[model samples]
Target: MENAKSKIKLGIYGIGLLMMGVIGISSSLSTIGAKFPEASQTMIQNLISIPCIVIIPTTIVVGKLMQTISKKNIALAGIIIFLIGGSAPAFMTSFTTILVMRGILGVGIGICQVVSTAIVADNFSGVEQQKVQGTLQASQMAGAAIMVFAGGWLTEVRWNYVFFVHLLAIISLILVAVMVPNTKPEKMTTTGDVQKTKLTSATWGWVIFMFILFISVQVYSISLSFLVTEKNLGTAADSGLGLAFFAIGGIIMGLLYGSLAKRTKNCAIAVGCLMLAVAYVVIAFAGSMIVCHIGSILVGMAVSAALPGIFINTGMSVDGFSAGMAISVVTCAQNFGQFCCPYIINPISASISGGRSVNFMCFIIGAVVAAALTILMLVWGVKKNRQVI
Candidate 1:
């Protein structure tokens, strides 16, 4: 492929937009829920699931279609879907309509998530691939930081104004659609020496990792309009700033990730997961709502470091695996966690105490997850290094 442009630059701007679009979908709902006291937290969580429900099957269908379709065609399809999804607030009423639009948004995000990364990977090789991926992730965190904060503020002024975040993605899509080269897949691996891993390992690991990560996300990522109003966390805009801090933590983690990984390969991911687990517990056990915000920032940091590692590792592990599957499983797991948290809490609240009791459980579960991940990563790392059990 021609050295058409700097892959790092391409990745940052491309993913910055895609990530902005993806996070915008969730944040719009969540941030709106944050400002408005009318909706229940459980209901808000349910809305988050709307997109995930649609994305599971859509991912596979899109993956298969990627083989034949022009990247331009697929991306255009994704953007149109995004525009529809983004316009939901402008067009729809009632919670149900919001959910329907969210599902459409999910399809767009799912398609672009996989396809965009694949385009970068297709164009770049070796160290450049790693750098580009890292840059893309950092850009994503940066976008989330800005967009979520903006969403929160917009919710206060006028909720529909938040929809404009999707417009930001247009630059990324247009650039990628026109400027990025469509190179044929080479027969050889981009990074040398590492054996092409099997589909079985890749698929199984992707699913497992996705589920694990989302478990923590349940407590971390909240559409907690209930809590926001209940606790009086300044204003809706201030609330988004809190979320932005979390994303900023993630950006810091991503920027530092390459150095972290060089030490133990999966060092960043392993530690990231461990931190997430701890953060989840902290969030669950939080007495004041402020603790929840702290936990969110910590969780975002872990997610920033861990998720890209999982995607890269999965991409490397399975030669035939679709990027759509990679994006799908991770996102589905995330949304699953978001869905399950409230569902679990609803039933538990009735049985135990009210919401407070459930929060404690969230913390306890997070602790257990951290311990499990710490053990798993260390064991895996040791084995990879050929150290004895």
Candidate 2:
């Protein structure tokens, strides 16, 4: 407990939380606006997908940067760059250019996100490390939660102003680096450990888990903004409420999921991912605005519960270079989903809905993927008759 309360340690977790906020902010804005009202849902889906396309390779730089510099330095550079890239839209006139800027923003997010868990391990150890991870994740979720309100308030002022809110998190990053003490990275003991503990097929399973995991959660995020405009459900302000549900679902899961995992013998994760798949189906098929809203909460919960399972399991399975690389791979998958979903889902939903099927189709795909993965996993599990703890 004393370790958890360490002021220096909180600073480290603060960096991770702020990076998550930068990650969450982009999706919030993509969906919440009316300027793109005439765009097909397919176009929105493309919007999400496009940035992800850019992000996959950019993570190479994140890996290289972490190799040469302190993780704190890597994070600091990302925060500074994200602050600029994220805030750029407020002053820019063209939405097309805004898309370009978002891709740049993805680069920063991709790197920082890939390095987030490593930073915890880099700075803290044992129970302090675990506690810091929990808090950092909570902070990230809280950041997502607050972004809804942030988006609402900022969009109320000016849509572009939403970028400025990212600066607050950047400030948090600056504070953490300055306040936290610098320590040499733990020495790598053996090439043997690296070879022995590398990510295996099972580890890749979790990597896939994080990928679909983010999509399931982000489906609500990017969709919320557009769903409002499409359904003629209130104003842009209402969009934030959906994301609020997303964050709330995540927070609730993050808070209680560990206990749930303990009691259910980690059933929360298995159930959570399955719920994510179903939530996608619910979102895709939802007819009424209220139903969509309820679906959003479920999607959020699934995301929240499932992430811890993925993290804990993945962390146990992978180590050293393999861990770092796997972290990059999974995180890249997340941003890619965020980047791609807007592009893929938006247009599909807008189309199926008769005008902009992007939202509908995207969620359906997300749902389908989640469901498919779960079913295949179950088949594999049953065939092997294996039980996971």
Candidate 3:
């Protein structure tokens, strides 16, 4: 049957979405200090954060280019670059060269980020589209978990071996080539009643909301190390364990996202934010690594559930042609939040806590702010649901 065949094709196409999340193999380098003892701490930190700088501009540029080029081609090109930049450093000893390669890797990730989301919007519609959106976020969280958890062990062999994890991008490249449809951007019609792609104020609202939401959510990872050291909770390995729990939470949340969304009448995001607020409160008062691990799991669940809602809402808020551009804007905002969480949260936390136990104070502040936002979001959801009824 044609319908049965279409379902098979959709299943294959979905695999491409999973590949987007795997390139995050870079996050597993927290233990680089053991391998690069000669480098200063600041320079070592740059090795991780510097790639984020290139990811933003490169994402926005690729979003614009999709109009004039094949989306499949752009994604394929990005994967090649990602593979080269991500894996080449494994063979080199120079810190400077590795950093350069990481920057290039960031560019490749930036391109894929935009293309991956756009690919979903292009292929599916309605509820099916939303399900795929959630799956994509789940895949990303799983990918990060895989890289960080596995990369941690691989680092025990040699830090350079961790860089080889980027080679996984090759699998994604093949999926994109064979599974994703090779089609040009949608052509605009010249006749009357052609739907002009105009993003409404609602679309912009989602973008700003995502920016602020990401700013709050990403703080957990940015502040984790300090939280561990200031509290004398445990070793770097313990912190790594906390991250693994976070990923597990995300995977669980992603699996239940569809059913939760239906039961909540689309208030799933509000509920997820409330959970994040509670998790932060728990972390603020955590006295043991066990407590912190619990908090990390909650943080992961909250982020995983909340992000897909934003992506699905953003997709629905715009036309197909504008979806790429709109989604790109929000994606840029999300990355920008990752880039700025430390600079923004550190001073605020220090001033609030008078520099003693800054991480705890930041968590407390994050909890209060997220709680307030949750109330507003819940109220909005109730009203919208009522109108639909």
Count of clashes in candidate 2? 42
lDDT of each: 0.63, 0.62, 0.72
Identify the leading candidate in terms of lDDT.
3
Candidate 2 C-alpha error for residue 96, in Å: 3.7
lDDT (tens digit, per residue) of candidate 2 on 1-389 = 45433765566556655555543443345443455776654454544455566667866567555655667677677777666666786688676787787677666666666667766655555444545555566656767767665776677666666666666666567666775555444435555332323567767786666666565566666665655566666455566666667667766766666565556544556677688887777766667667766777787677766665565555666665456666666666666656655555555555675554555566776776777666665565344334652
**Tens-place lDDT digits, model 3, residues 171-190:** 77676677666778755565
* Clash count per candidate: 1, 42, 0
Which of the predicted structures, 1 or 3, would earn the higher TM-score when compared with the native? 3
| Candidate 2 global CA lDDT score | 0.62
Give lDDT tens digits, candidate 1, residues 1-389: 34466643563356455553545534455556655568776666655566655665665666556556655567667777876786665555566777777778878866776666666555555666666666677777777787777777776677778766666666666766666555433334566543332355656676676776666555545433334444454555655666777788778877777776676675567787788777766655555557767876787788777776777766666555344445545555555554465566446544654555444554565557766877787677667656422
Tell me the lDDT of model 2 at 361.
65
Model 1 misplacement above 4 A: 1-12, 20-40, 183-198, 223-225, 281-294, 320-341, 344-364, 387-389
lDDT of 1: 0.63
Worst 10 residues of 1 by lDDT: 222-231
For model 2, the superposed segments whose C-alpha errors exceed 4 Å read 1-5, 20-51, 122-132, 186-198, 213-216, 281-291, 342-358, 376-389
TM-score ranking, best first: 3, 1, 2
